[model samples]
Target chain A: MSTIDVNGTAVEVDEEGYLVDLGSWTPEIGTALAKGDDCELTDNHWEVINFLREYYEEYQIAPAVRVLTKAIGKKLGKDKGNSKYLYELFPYGPAKQACKYAGLPKPTGCV
Target chain B: MSDVKKFLYVNRKQPYGTIYALESLEVVLIGAAFEQDVSLAFVDDGVYQLTKGQDPSGIGMKNFSPTYTALGDYDINKIYVEKESLEARGLTIDDLQHLTWEDEDEDWAEKDSIRVVSASEMAEIMDQQDIVLSF
Candidate 1:
């Protein structure tokens, strides 16, 4: 475990950079995490991150990438649902990277 | 002949009391990716896993009851709950969440995924599985 400073507030994070305490997440923390990877959080990115947070809130688990793709298609339209689109948003794997920003555990069944 | 094998996961433990329930759920989700014939059985204390309005926050455990609803999305639609188990615990089908899946071929028509069965019927179903894993 380590701590990441989000504007002077240190929050605990796991080795993989996932928030150790999910409740510690804020939009700032998310932005900081994205910044650490040299990636900017665009509205399109926030769309998926926010969706993951909401999905975790309702299902209590981060969805597998396949499930995420289908669900995104259902909610965000087919253009934004495919893995190609999701990969473009979170190139380091949609379920893993987006879930980390969303303060969720690595998706169940994610390799 | 189709190469798919019938797999039955037998869950008999209460959620959060042990790791078996969560482990079973994870395995089910992973195994579903293989496109095999998979089904789940809830008997004994396992019925509690499906009870609705579960809030494990006070217990410091993730409330995974909601995850059961995702099983339908994984194409694991055949969920068997033993009737005797529910009666012994003072729970009826109404106490559980209504889980369903959409049939794509049927124009996304929603269909129920849970089936309450007698203990004897559960045994008959178990007998038909190519693989039966108990937890």
Candidate 2:
């Protein structure tokens, strides 16, 4: 089984490897994670983060990178969909880093 | 450090074209690996991620949707879909695999416990979440 420590919180992994306690998260925790990564939360970051939260509430799963970009494009307009723009905001990788900062689990199929 | 936190993922794009879906899933899995609570929501064309019968081999890309099944391995359950999104895309609950469906007709009085919701309702969910990330 795999496990990770978030803000010193030791979380257990399930059989499929996902976390079991989603109700415990808070925005402040997400901000702390982003700060640890040297990222400054901005309005743009909030846009993506807010979007992901809503998405998860409805679907209960994470979106892959491809879907994330297209959705960003559609919602924020095409100018924001391009990889260049997304990468600029999340240098460590938009989908990966942003989801982490948002306090969500790591996305699937990532190395 | 005290406890794992809830993290929401919003998917709104198509299945292919970029690394949005793939990368987002990676983050979700990683979060789960760390013991954080994670959930996913599909809206707009993002719903395509759950569509059945995908064939990415022709395009030279791996069939990424298969990763959806792997999500359970990470314990990152709690997948959701927007009712309007499914209807707009002409997809039904049967078209999707490996997820719990929330019909549009379900109760929404509590707001937080709702599964299927309208676009606006989905937005409201985002607002209430401590952290929201859109992929």
Candidate 3:
């Protein structure tokens, strides 16, 4: 376990940098997480991050990349749903990197 | 279809108080990528997994019951709930969450994923599977 400072408060995260307690997540923490990777959270990035948060709220499990892509196409738009679009937003891997910023555990079946 | 094997996941435990139910769901999601013909059987105490309004927050555990609703998006639509198990637990089909999938072959018509089956019918389903994974 490791800690990241969010607004002077230490937040516990796993070795993989995922939040140890999901409820501790906040938009500021998400921005801090993205900054650690030197990736800035733009409106585009926040869109996917917010989507992931809502997805987790309803399903209680982070979706695998394939499922996430298809679902994004349905809820967002086809133009923004493809892996190319998502990958461009998070070069490290859409489900992995985006889920990290969204404070969701690594997506199920990701590995 | 010749290359696709029929896989059956037999769940016989309660949703909580054990890890089997959660492990089974994870396996099913991972296995869905293989595009096999998959079916889930909820027998014995497993019937409790599908019951509606599961609140595990009180137990300090993640409430994963809602994750079952995502099964439809994974193309796993064949969910069989044992009639005997539900009756033994004093639950009816209405007590479970309603799950459905879109039928692409039928112009994307939404179809129910859960089917209540008798023990004998469930046995027949098991006999038809090429692979049976117990959880």
The number of the candidate with the highest lDDT is: 3
The candidate 3 chain B region of ten consecutive residues with least summed lDDT is B100-109
Q: What is candidate 1's lDDT per residue for B8-122, written digit by digit as tens?
A: 9999999998999999998998888788999999999999989999888998987888889988778889999999999999999999999999887897799999999999999
Ranking by DockQ, best first? 3, 1, 2
Give every collision pair in model 3.
none
Better of 1 and 2 by TM-score: 1
lDDT of 2 by residue, A1-111 (tens): 655566687654444433456666677666666766678899998899888777565445556666577668767988998788889999988877887766566655456
Error of 2 at A105 (Å): 20
Q: Which is the better candidate, 1 or 3, if ranked by DockQ? A: 3
Better of 1 and 3 by lDDT: 3
TM-score of chain B of 1: 0.97
Question: What lDDT would candidate 3 get against the real structure?
Answer: 0.92
Backbone clash pairs for candidate 1 read none
Expressed as tens digits, the lDDT of each residue in B10-120 for candidate 3 is 999998899999999999988987889999999999999999999998899878899999998889999999999999989999999999998868967999999999999
Interface RMSD of 2: 9.5
Provide interface RMSD per model, one decimal: 1.0, 9.5, 1.0
Candidate 3's iRMSD:
1.0
Q: How many collisions between residues are there in candidate 2?
A: 64
> Across residues A1-111, which tens digit of lDDT does each residue of candidate 3 receive?
799888899889888888888888889999988888899899999999999999989988888888889888878989998999999999999999999999999988777
